[model samples]
Target: MEKIPILRMGDFLLVTIQIDMHDQLALKLQDDLSNAIQQHASKGVLIDISTLEMVDSFIGRMVADISGMGRILGAQTILVGMQPAVAITLVELGLSLPGVATALNVERGMEILRRKIAADGTDERPG
Candidate 1:
């Protein structure tokens, strides 16, 4: 029963997946992230998945769901750090993660999220 941590950084939430997540853990993470977005009134979510070597359909769907949920909550979601092999496997497994924003690393992800929030007129002022 591993719990993923959601860290708050200014107007964004950072979710760093440090281990290969299982089904239950992934679901819990999705729930936690949604709650954090609302609780913090976050403008964005950056998920770092660099440590994961593989992802199943369940995990892939969870990631997609998290992105969708973030959007519904008025937050932008960026998934970062996907290894090339892992990404290829996800595509081969038919999980392209449609409508999800991806980046090569956390730095780029933050830049994208910030730009999207600004473009959406989210008013990301210091609180």
Candidate 2:
């Protein structure tokens, strides 16, 4: 089974989806990411999906579920690098992905996460 890689960057978890998403892969990603967030005590999650040209309803819902799960785990989730067509498909499929923040790229996504951490006034940086 192919798995997506989740990297830890400071107080955030970064996920870059480089391959096409299947049902099983998406499920695995959700489980793995949930574990990572708790283990790392992540404050935020940045998911980069720029490489994906399209997204089916299942993939779209999985993305939303990941974001919600992150929130439940006490981490903010930001989705970045979404293609225009993918966005359209998501809307067409009625997946608005409520409560999920989005960014144009990884750099901007990281910035949003930093701003969120600052706003929360609970910096997890090591002294």
Worst 10 residues of 1 by lDDT: 118-127
Which candidate number would show the highest lDDT if scored against the true structure?
1
Residue pairs whose backbone atoms clash in candidate 1: none
How many clashes show up in model 2?
Answer: 0
Model 2, 33-111: lDDT tens per residue?
9999999999999999999888888887788898889988889999999999888878888888887899999999999
Question: If scored against the real structure, what TM-score would every candidate get?
Answer: 0.92, 0.91
Candidate 2 residue 6 Cα shift, in angstroms, is 0.7
Question: TM-score of model 1 relative to the true fold?
Answer: 0.92
